[model samples]
Target chain A: MEWDWDFAWSIMPTLLAGFRITLIATFLGAIVAAVLGLVFAILRRSSNRWLSRGTSFVVEFIRGTPLLVQLYFIFYVLPDLGLRLPALMAGVIGMGLHYATYAAEVYRGGIESVPRGQWEAARATNLTTRQTWLHVILPQAVPPMIPAMANYLLAMFKETPLLSAITVLELMNQAKSVANSSYRYVEPMTLVGVMFLIVSLLSVIALRWLERRYGRVSQ
Target chain B: MGDWAGYLTLILQGAWVTVKLTLMGSALALVVAFLAGLGRISHHAPIRWLSTAYIEFFRGTSIFVQLFWIYFVLPMTGAELTPMQAGVMALGLNVGAYGAEVVRGAILAVPRGQHEACIAVNLTRWQRLRHVILPQALPLMLPTFCNNAIELLKATSVVSLISLSDMTFQAQVVRSQTGSTLMPFVTILVLYFAMSSAISFGMRRIERRVTRGLDGVR
Candidate 1:
């Protein structure tokens, strides 16, 4: 079959809309993750054993399972308890929550990697715990986390296709809808693949540069 | 949804398929990963580029989107494989990309001093890679390899979209039949949790055993 640029171009309108949703959902979801990860990472290292243990359990629980099923629970099962979130909201929530667990470990590793002498210096200066973390440790920790965080961001973008299962018409959903309605799987999916390739290649290049730049600083 | 008889039977069926696919797919991905991973770090520029391209293409694309392409596009292209084949192929390819990273990282993680030691001992390339490098890399790779294997298992649910009778598919089937979406899906969710947790728990034991050998080396 010959390639059909006209057909591919027409579907671009819907696909673009879906791409917007996918981008927003991923970007916003990543923000949630960055915050939740910091919270859980700190909680896991807290002085209180109960708080640390409880946070660890929650993180492990979320990380151990599939995001798809978790999203199903958020989107499908949650309504049973009379809390009906919008499909997009539920999707971002599920994706954010599931990835937060993984990101928390990343944060923990970043935090713990600070040299012990740094802590001693802060202590010697009579810095509060908050002051020490904000001033002494975090600035040292966050740069290395940037590349890892970028990887997660790209991963989250790829995962936006899953939100379609919950009726959020992200990129893949639009491609599927076009395929289903037009009875032409060839062009739309091909275009979708190209679009994904472009986006993710950009992600790779951006991530690589970030990794190299911050990697030098962290070391 | 502790309706034991119903959920148990459904999840059991899904669990069987999940385990089977994870094993089969990971097995395939591992074999290819070793080659591609080595290719990635090869002295030959073309070999390195080829592996890098392979990794980036799969890594960049959504696994579910790839699943759809295999399931939908391949049929239109006249390669009429089953849903299972498409599902397995997508997953093996996806995990293979990740496994390449693990393998390459693990190899690089080997101490540079060891490479000098191998050279000083007059070890051949194959001997150094097989007897020295890979042995050390295996233990380091195991934890990450197993994690990807579990993620692939969780990913098997995507095959349900193409009509594979996987766990998520079974859950969907049960939900539609019973008109009770929450219970059916909740049961499926718990089954995934149990299966993944079990995999991680088992791998953790193995990680401990592996690390035990390396203890006090530094």
Candidate 2:
């Protein structure tokens, strides 16, 4: 099939709109991942055995399951339980929860890597628990987390196409719509793939820059 | 489909399929990935380039699109396979690419001192790799391989579109028959969640055992 610049040019506007949705979903999902990551991290380290094990169980369960199944659960199950999230909300929640399992691991690694002496010093100075966490441990642990976190962010961006299953008009959905209406999978699907590749590549490159920008954590 | 007991049995059936797909696909991927991974680190340039190209091509595309290409497009070109066959093939190839990276990385992680020792002892190439290198690499590779295994297991759900009667398909069946989307989906999600959590827990235990043995060596 011949490449048509005109069709590609015309589709850009639709894909751009889809790009906006993708960005929003990725950004929002990252927020949940960050907060929930901290929660999981703390829970996994808690002195209480049940809490830590339970949290670990949750993390493993979520990690092991496919995000697609999770999405289906959120979309199909919620409405029957007398609640209905917007399709986008469902998409974002599934992405957030699914990736939170991974982010928890990253957070756990970051937290565990904090020097034991730091905790000892915190107790020596008689800092409050909150102060110990906020002032000392997090500062040390979170810096190295930036690059890994950014990588997850990009991963989430690529996963937005999976959101189309729930009827979210993300880039792939738009491409599918165009393809279905016009019967041209050749151009639309290829374009969608190319667009995703370019954006994700840029995201990865930017993340590499962030790693260099915050090398203290790793170095 | 809506009867709780009947729904239970159907999901159990689906769970069986999910297990089969996950195990079979992972086993195939492990074999292919090991070879490609070895090729990637081979002495020859062509082997290296071919492995690299394979990895990059598969990794660059989304697995969903790839599944569609193999399942939907291949039939039109006169190469016909069942949805289950195509699904397994796609999953195997896709996961193989990522596994190759893990395999290569794990091999490289083997200590350089060991490599030098092997050379000093005049061990054959295969002897050094098989006896010394792979043993060390295997344990280090366990944690990452477990991670990929879980990821690939979860991905087996993508095969539902080609009409494989996996857990996802069973959930769809219940959803269609009962119109009670929530119950069926929630049940299936929990089913998947349970299976994955069990596997991961087992993996962690294995990793601990492997690491303990490594510590003993030191």
Candidate 3:
């Protein structure tokens, strides 16, 4: 019940190690989300009707479902289907796959914000479709999306605790283990909460900076 | 088929719990959202500071951590809470922090001309907010509020970790008992998707109804 500084100090190393894994999972998962989300965004806008509709359905389904359930499916059912993944790998993929739906929305918004005039101008100048996208559309689209994407990064980081459910040794998992072993719930749980608070607050400050720098453009 | 049917019934019972948590949590979140959101823009500095602190602290920590702390550590400090109570509180407060921002933004987005009109008529601040500002702001808040409601629904899944026996927890129970991982997980995923879709659908209807008279203002 009482605050035990010694107990908290003793568990610091274990919690820190777990925090390292949390950071790694978040970083790798962000990469997966960024790339996959872009792919999803483009595919949803494809010329083929079936491809666009199918992509939209998949994105909607993923967005509608909970990340925790998605994590459970990837970690539990995949092994039964003869595809085993380590907890961290499964966690990363689940986080990436889940957040990708959101990131795709950001990308879609950014892409849509590029004016019709720009697309017409590209065509009038005799730019090829690919060149129009590469040289003009994306250059205009990507900047505003950065802050939204970074917000999701922080969101995924907060959710790294959920990775503990799938057995990843993230900060929450380590704290739980320490709590279980020592039969002391207060210190470790509070520490985990404090750690998350610190990281999220810092990321929020960074996101504000990003917004100020890139939030407004002439689109 | 019989065994599967039995599993479905059990999972439905859990689904009921999930629905209850989502509804109760969302109701509490709505109250907290309005309070903190309005408080943030209050005339007094301390009121604004207090709301800001409330929003930042809850928003900064993940809901899972908050649930565990409430369920586990809060009792140590003498405030015992049932799992359901804790789930509702954590989900409400956490999601409320987000809803607060939405409320603030919507209020701010109301045209500056509208505020000038309120002052020109010599309405008190409370009368202005209640009669003029809130009516306009309420419609603007609906779409984002719909999204936040879906978010709160998904968040109820995390309450399962605290042994709350929400749909996610019941799925685990079914999985362990039947030794069938896919069925339980798949069923709940569909259920969750359905619930979220329902929230969006209902919100859309309300949004349409609310904006019916004020066509060009939006």
Winning model by lDDT: 3
Q: What is the C-alpha lDDT of each candidate?
A: 0.85, 0.82, 0.93
List ranges where model 3 is wrong by over 4 Å: A216-219
TM-score of chain B of each: 0.90, 0.94, 0.97
lDDT of 3 by residue, B1-218 (tens): 34988899989999999999999999999999999999999989999999999999998999999999999999999998999999999999999999999899889989999999999999999999998899899998998899889989999999999998989999999988977888999999999999999999999999888788788766
Question: For model 3, which pairs clash?
Answer: none
What interface RMSD does candidate 2 have? 2.3
What lDDT, from 0 to 1, does candidate 3 have? Answer: 0.93
lDDT value, residue A197 of candidate 1: 90
| Candidate 1 CA-lDDT value | 0.85
Question: What does candidate 2's lDDT look like per residue over B159-208, in tens digits?
Answer: 88668889998989888888878777778878887777777788899887
Give the winner by lDDT: 2 or 3: 3
Candidate 3: residue A112 lDDT (0-100):
92
Interface RMSD of each: 1.4, 2.3, 0.8
Worst 10 residues of 3 chain B by lDDT: B209-218
Query: Taking the tens digit of each residue's C-alpha lDDT, what string does model 2 give over A128-200?
Result: 9999999999999888888888877777776777888889998778877887787655566667767777776
TM-score of 2: 0.88
Error of 2 at B18 (Å): 1.8
* Deviation in Å, model 2, residue B109 alpha carbon: 1.1
- DockQ for model 3? 0.88
Number of the candidate with higher DockQ, 1 or 3: 3
- Runs with alpha carbons beyond 4 Å of true place in candidate 2: A1-10, A46-50, A213-219, B73-78, B201-216
